[model samples]
Target: MSKQFFVTFCLLFITFYGKCQVTCSLPNKKAFETKIDSLNKIDLDSLNPSQKITSIAETFLGEPYMEKTLDIDIKKETVVINFTGFDCTTFVENMIALTKLYTGDQNEKYRTLEHYASILEHIRYRNGKLKGYTSRLHYFTDWVRNNQAKGIVKDITVEIGGQTYDKNIDFMSTHITAYDQLVKNDSAISAIRLIEDDLNQTPLSQIYIKDISKVESKIQSGDIIALVCNVKGLDVAHVGLALRKEDGRIYLLHASQSKGKVVITDKPLAEWLKNSKLNTGITVARLN
Candidate 1:
């Protein structure tokens, strides 16, 4: 996607939310802590992680993409530049970095550079060469499911964003910034975060999808489906995870600029089905 398209998408994405589908809530810090504690003891192999992850992910329900830069607690470490880097995809990068640190990996200082890494490379490193960055692959759902299959991370549900999510259902979301929409208006104060991947650059060909079958099999609860709009180049717009599937319609939750804020909705992929190019792209991949 060109810089022109990127900015345009960002501008229009939030406007989509102005249409207003359903109202969502954010969990308080107290609720967040209680839910995460539950994840510490679950036998990940026996159950799904969506609800568990969703519980906490929702705490950031309405956060902006740039607030992550300002929210980190750095313990008064010579504040030079307090950047507001709140974005859904980057938030996921931060979470992955923290998880790696939790695993106690000696390489990359565990929490330092890993948080900023791109989704493809992160998955490739975690899953290795066999899963070399899949270009057409878009959204965190695809990556999380892949990791779950390899046992790199497990899912569990906890309270977040004032809503209870089944960890199994959590896998279907993207990260967004949580800030004061009124005061911050365009900003949020972040405590010097230790996470933020320098490598998690957005790909032009990436887009969000609700149906996994469009690109792969099973649009499972936690898969991040990418709806590719890049008929000519790389994917341009990406929402969050493909979380809910209902009434034969797949629903997703993400920090959409299209909605001008964080939102949950269904029917995007269904709408795309009418496009001829999309129909062909999906078919070609199946044959390949």
Candidate 2:
């Protein structure tokens, strides 16, 4: 879509769903717009969707890894989009939202921070509607599933020989106190329990760490990579974009909590997988 059409979509979306929206407050909102405007000035019309996403993600390489970038006041559950900082998941989330704005149907444009907010609401919520805390796509697997269902991405794990494993999700509700929003909201807690129950009824899959090396060449840049964990209740512990360097090696471009900033992994994909004992494997989703 073009810039004019994107602005139209944002206006229409807000007008249609204003009641369910949360107040978006960003201190550097204008600066972000300037940044995006500058990015738009680049000759990216010839690039594919994945290339656009990769280029966008690379721009934030040195951004600090601020934990809880999404957590706002407990009473307001807005779709938070912060360029000032990012966690691993938000890093992928923003890149995907920006990619959609750049390449979505040729007529789309994000003219303001609210436009980005609308894009994020669609990307981060169930059925693209921000109803409440429960509507947030908290789990990476659920995020993949919802976005894929909306035709935003496609799960390519099975095509790459991923094997099905028992699903064991429930971390959010079980550890309710850890989340500020979920602690006082009983309704939110109940909704999460339902989501967890549904997740438990299904089988999930991933490409085992042992097998990532075998298909490393098939991995492409801008592909969303979820680092699966061996933890009892979680499907993924971290996420990032697959960045293929000129040396023909695929490294992870992610927000490193350890380093307190975003950085591309020094080790290659397989070697990096070996570095984390908690990393059981990986699940990949390609943006459409």
Candidate 3:
């Protein structure tokens, strides 16, 4: 057999039979592959979706919190995946993506880093396609809405007695410097304005900090927790996952920008919110 044909045959062979782990080599593949390999080292076959997510999140408790980990300096936007460090949004999204990939039949096609990238593309982008800098879900509210609409998660905030909160979300367009991609791209800024305008008109709901105690029992492990803020021009201030500890209390497992590390909050969920001056309330999205 010719050398080139031999290599192609091996690649084709693995595509069909390699169903044990994510092995596709892509940009930042080492970090991404390490995460998948860690999860695969154990038999996660018995855990449910929520359990699977929390289980994986707990393994990264002390990982350093890195801001703008996905900030690409390129002229064109690309899907950036890094597991070594995480911001609040990436941490929650990573856990969600891992949970989705970890569950289901092992024989299914989630056996490569490329598959995880595909899953992240769907969860991170609007309508599951990366268009440009503007296509990413910059706001947690919009993130929840898009992912929920895709049946990846269900918004359970209102069902748990969350109250309506009137607010406008245009922070990304207004503060372009916060995102490197928007700084030079006027088109990206304009596109974000349209998204912000739509979100401004939409009514948002959240569990008031005072009411969180009432719905504390309803919040489950692995649920996406977005802290709704009272800040003008912004919706959620931070994002995390709910970690219901063995003692029956829910805590925030998140990439803490404040502490610069991933941590499960020392205080209970409700108490943590009550003490948070910037956080006014929270919106919950349960994994489907």
Candidate 4:
């Protein structure tokens, strides 16, 4: 089917189901369908959630890194499915969404592109509803916290030797010009400020950089690894899935800004964190 027709179908589906009105963007529709088809053929029954995450994540190994793909529409938000390129957050979110498609009900009705978009919306938006630009889970900690409440994932940072991550999260509101939506939109800025305020009081925890090595053995493959930032007013600087290589050390499988593509870190995650001044620690979560 043509991309236009597919998008129209998605719109009709969403409207018929009383879902939030949103545009769907699938730049590579054939590629997406092929991916879903291939994944559907896999025996996911044998694999655990972590294995399923890594199995799906490896498919985007060399995809180009593209920042701000979600900012396609200034006046409205789009359910964007871009297989061609990804930022760190999109890569991790899509990985979980795809895994959900397979692990969810086996009925054919649950495997359509619209269904995939629903899964993505659930993972990306707060409380699984798309009200506006501010509704997106811009903060990684908030994303984990909300998803954990829905039984999608569990924050395991504290269990693996994490300490309180006490930093005021007002980055987006403070740096308004950096975001186009927040620049001229007073309501968007106000919504973000409120979100930051709530997050600051949410009581977050992270594994400090100095202690990452001590708990490296406990972090499993396919665990979500959020690079906790030392920068002012920010909660997370980067995000990726953990991959325990044959060398028995966990490496970051992420969309690398430096490489301009998706890649596994050349060194172990602990050593990788040492190279960055902005990154102070990590917050780990597991798919439930």
Candidate 5:
């Protein structure tokens, strides 16, 4: 992708209050089409559909987080759609919004760029208390747990290649897109390390999978998983997505905010649970 495209993506989320008018009904499947319709109702008709997808993604970057609504779409599971600055709730919202593209479809499994508009819903909150609003964003874990509870989610697990290990060891109780399992583990970690940890170099992507089996075993076929790690006991860490795998090696893709969107990489089936936790002694959790 071009830097301009990436730049626009970042800005879209940043300029949420700048002049965008959301005019669609909330929570309704029709909201997807109408949300995109409002955008198309704009003067940017010259842009193609892909460009439009990027534009839509960028437009709702930080529209706050609504606990009951999923109104923003995170890029195809490959991208974290996260910057350290982008709080946890927004991640959940993005996931919902992006899914609008694939909602009501049976064959769709991964995030596709084709359904960009269906992902956005026109709505907002009058206050945190939640009253009459078009959107309802769920708390990250609550959202996932609820989805899992409601059957919208199949299960959560760690995966690489064609193999998946779903078991709850230590990290199964929380929700977060692990930096390692996130977009491109090495890339997300490297970029985050540069921006946050101030580290100079990172490992090539080696890991241990003791407890990972517990987590992967439960992950439903279409669910997204996060990977994380740090030193043995310290707290600093990296995160990412374990979208899926090919053959036997788990292939991953993520948006290392610092590195930009959806880049591909690979790792062992359980690259994060080296010593039963994220290899670096980090923590792992599911994303809402």
Candidate 6:
């Protein structure tokens, strides 16, 4: 082959490889289309971002809690969307993605599965690029920081009566055997360790369980709440959306592990946190 032709061929090959890397798994295509059509008909112009989020989140109230739905393949990272079931992180991510989709302009380009995938990829991965398994935001604090940088969210932990949560985060790297991808992968483990090191440098801020009651007034509905864990080497145990109900108190809207489905907690936010011995406090992020 001629030098120029060879170079062009290589470039084309690379482009094809990059485009083929992401495999999207939309389990319920008809449901997805129906939901999208419904969102398109809604008068989102009257609602703010928070209202949009809560409105979107409430639609998935009965979604079964399924762990590791994102782990579509052990070798390849797929943009997996399961409206039928959601883990806590997936529930939060999907709610935010759907709200963004609902609130965005009604251009034909914006109303496609690919556009939704692009939005989800931006929200789920680091700097919105999916390089590999490690590219996924494993840490909730990291997720908040990256999304904040992208103008998707603003970390309101410090603004709402929070204090420094000084601790090292290395749970994933240390517990590599627990993760299928990291069980024998040295490179992935190394990358996670580096991420953990960076996280340790910046102390996270959280509203203590004792102080959450005082700051309940500030936490608005549709705000993302990360349950900061007391567990060693873990920054966040779980995450969900905050909902201020008619009774004038904040409640958690999350994919509950114990309940095996997505549901609003019966108790208020403060009481819920107080009940969990594993949870230390909360890191709040509001959609921007």
Name the weakest run of 10 consecutive residues (lDDT summed) in model 5. 126-135
Candidate with more favorable, higher lDDT: 1 or 4: 4
lDDT of 3 by residue, 12-110 (tens): 311111221122323346666666777778767888888888898998999899887656444655666676688999998888888878767754355
* lDDT, residue 132, candidate 2: 76
How would you encode candidate 4's per-residue C-alpha lDDT over 127-149 as one tens digit per residue? 99888899999989899999998
What TM-score goes with each of the models?
A: 0.37, 0.89, 0.87, 0.91, 0.35, 0.90
Global lDDT of each model?
Answer: 0.34, 0.81, 0.81, 0.85, 0.33, 0.85
Q: Which stretches of candidate 1 lie over 4 Å from their true place?
A: 1-46, 67-85, 94-217, 245-248, 266-268, 272-288
- lDDT-based ranking: 4, 6, 2, 3, 1, 5
Number of colliding residue pairs in model 6 = 0
lDDT score, residue 254, model 5? 36
Q: How accurate is candidate 6 locally (lDDT)?
A: 0.85
Question: How does model 3 score by TM-score?
Answer: 0.87
Q: Please identify model 3 stretches exceeding 4 Å from their true place.
A: 1-28
TM-score of predicted model 1?
A: 0.37
lDDT of 1: 0.34
Tens digit of lDDT per residue, candidate 1, span 264-286? 65364445334535422110100
| Candidate 3 positional error at 158, Å | 0.5
Q: Can you write out model 6's per-residue Cα lDDT over 38-130, one digit (the tens) per residue?
A: 776766667999998998788778879999888878887766666667899999998999888777565645766667777888999999888
TM-score of decoy 5: 0.35
The candidate that wins on lDDT is 4
Candidate 6 residue spans exceeding 4 A from truth: 1-26
Judge candidate 4 at residue 83 and give its lDDT: 66
